[model samples]
Target: MANIKIITDSTCDLSSAIVKELNIAIVPLYVVFKDVSYRDGVDITAAELYSKVNKLKELPKTSAPSPKDFHEVFKPYIDNGDDILYIGLSSRLSSTIQNAKIAANEFPEGRIKIIDSFNLSTGIGLLVLMAADFVKEGLTLKEIFARIQESLPKVKTSFVINTLEYLHKGGRCSAIQSFVGGMLKIKPIVQVVDGRMILGHKTRGKIEKSLRSLIELTMKDKDRIDLKRIIITHSEADEEAKLLKKGLEEALSPKSIIITSAGCVISSHCGPKTVGIIYLTK
Candidate 1:
């Protein structure tokens, strides 16, 4: 058995199968609609969240897990004599990272390490996957921590939102402006830079151009890519994601490519047709 255990929150957006295979523990965030609340991946799913968003009068709101929630999730393994490494969503975007840190302090005598991934969704998922691989290879908790810290900046993520309506509804963009842009069918290509989302380029014609732009950016270092570990994640847009995957494979010809749904926590913000790519670089 691995001496160290990996833990992360639902915001990481990793699938249940991968989590189980990696022996990773996930603490769920909360999603509230009207008067009802549900645990992120437990009671709410990406498809369900998008369905509700389409029918509801108002957009649903998301809440980060509290320190108590983190404590509850951590106590199990820590008490069982496993060293814990709690990787979390970006500190810039949510207080979840801070909450995890607070909970880690609560067990001062136990071996627990909380790390702010400085990323969200599949961005964090990619990092957690790398950390899990290291742990499975029998690396010590300290070595795994050092590996994650060294690799954080080398991971690149870029995405394209089919429409800005979701960002507007979530208060990440101006409603009136995004609404107007959506009517024009403008697709925005965005990238995660310095731990925050920023606009990269925009096209008024098709999502294909936006997707092409993402690939071009990723393939800029085509001669030296470690293609064995490329990942693609989307928000309820499997068709588009499939198309993007096909295009990426033909272009880069990576050794492996992983495609999965971005969890409800991110889908809640990016909405239904967001597509993204994550890759590890030298």
Candidate 2:
């Protein structure tokens, strides 16, 4: 078996348990509130993050891990004689992958490979797990890199915002738009297309309707879904996420459905009750 290490950033939204079990090294991003900063998922928890936001009445700013941060995480594994595969947040969304590349350059060539996931939350997590699986199968680093690149475009990521408050606070939408959307109970669907967030459909009435809309949209690709795994990730919306999970179970019947809470970085933007579906297509 080849000696290898899998690494990802905290924006991936994977649980610590899974990270520990897989032995994946995670370099944390930063969540800044005024002059104070905390490492996403390391120095902060989702509940605490939400509480701080509510108390401050503003969304916190998120930052990518620095090149130095990546170096610290990479050094131990390299010293142990292990090659590394780092699946990171999208270059379009943040400079995290760029920083990882800078850190990789400090090491010998071919010892590390960096992949731009072009995704966030569980979308990136899905790719990280896929790379880990390839490693466990004893695939060579070269072969695993090719497989990951092929699978990159197959990742499907979309989510529904339960409230427009956070979006407005973060300047994503204007106050008037937030007011009108709130009055009508309109939930906006955000889709990850070409490595950027684009507004998709808007569902009215209740949050449940939007959640159902997500399931319906996903079912359109049922025939092509990889079916190996599906992830439903939420920011303080466990019950709503469970509803979506049940609906997905009856409709798609995928082999595995995992539920994870979004980390501080994702939660800071999406706000409470935001839920997203992430999966791969064959």
Candidate 3:
């Protein structure tokens, strides 16, 4: 092995068990509400954030981890003489990767490598796991980097927003538009395209209809899917996510399916009841 250490941001939506099992390090971002700041995964959790949002009737603002924060996380690894690989959320979505780059410059040139996952939630988690797999194969840093770079474009990150309240509050849509959409129960399918969230299809009626529409869209080109692994992630949406998982299991029959909750960063933006299926396509 190459004495490698893997680091990722809290937006990866990976569980504590998996992070510990993989021996991965996570640098947390910040979620600020009512002038109080909480570390993404450390101080705040998805359910707590959502409860506050509903109680306060406002969405929290999220900030990327500072370069100094990354330095703190990188220090122990560098002192141990281990080469560090930090996979971060999209530069376009948040400045997490850019800040990591700034922190990496504080150390020796080849000691740290920062990868912009160009993804969020478990989509980034999948990429982190992929890198860990390559590490177990005894690949050098150079080889691992090459493999990761190649796999970046294949990572699919997306979600179905159960409500547009946050979107309207964020001014992504007009109040009247949101009011009308909410009245009609219009759920928008949102996906990461070129590192930013874009509204995809508008599915009307109940949330279940939108989820089925999402599954249909996912399996429309089922033949091209890798089917090796799939992730279903949500924000305060256990039953809805499991329903999506049920359909996906019947359709793709992936080798493994992982379900997890969105972390502070993801939950801050998407609000509650946001669910999505993330997978790689061949």
- Per-model CA lDDT versus the true structure: 0.84, 0.91, 0.89
Tell me how many clashing residue pairs each candidate has.
Answer: 0, 0, 0
Q: TM-score: which is higher, 1 or 3?
A: 3
- lDDT for each residue of candidate 2 in 22-123, tens digit (9 for 90 to 100): 999999999999979899988999899989987988788889999999999999899989999999888998999999999999999999999998888889
User: Which candidate has the top score in lDDT?
Assistant: 2
Predicted structure 1: lDDT: 0.84
What is the TM-score of each predicted model, taking all chains together? 0.95, 0.98, 0.97
Give candidate 2's root-mean-square deviation (CA, Å): 1.0
lDDT tens digits, residues 31-56, model 3? 89988999988998888888888899
What digit string (tens of lDDT, one per residue) describes model 1 on residues 1-282? 437989999988887899999889999988899978889989988898878877885678888899999899888887888899888888888889989988899885548877788788877888899888887788888888888988888778888888788888888888776977878888887788878888777767787777787788777868766687888999878888898899889998998888988887888888778999988788
> Which residue window of length 10 is worst by lDDT in model 2?
191-200
- Model 2: residue 84 alpha-carbon error in angstroms: 0.6
Kindly provide the TM-score of model 2 when superposed on the true structure, using C-alpha atoms: 0.98
Candidate 1 wrong stretches, greater than 4 Å: none
C-alpha positional error of residue 89 in candidate 3 after TM-score superposition, expressed in Å: 0.7
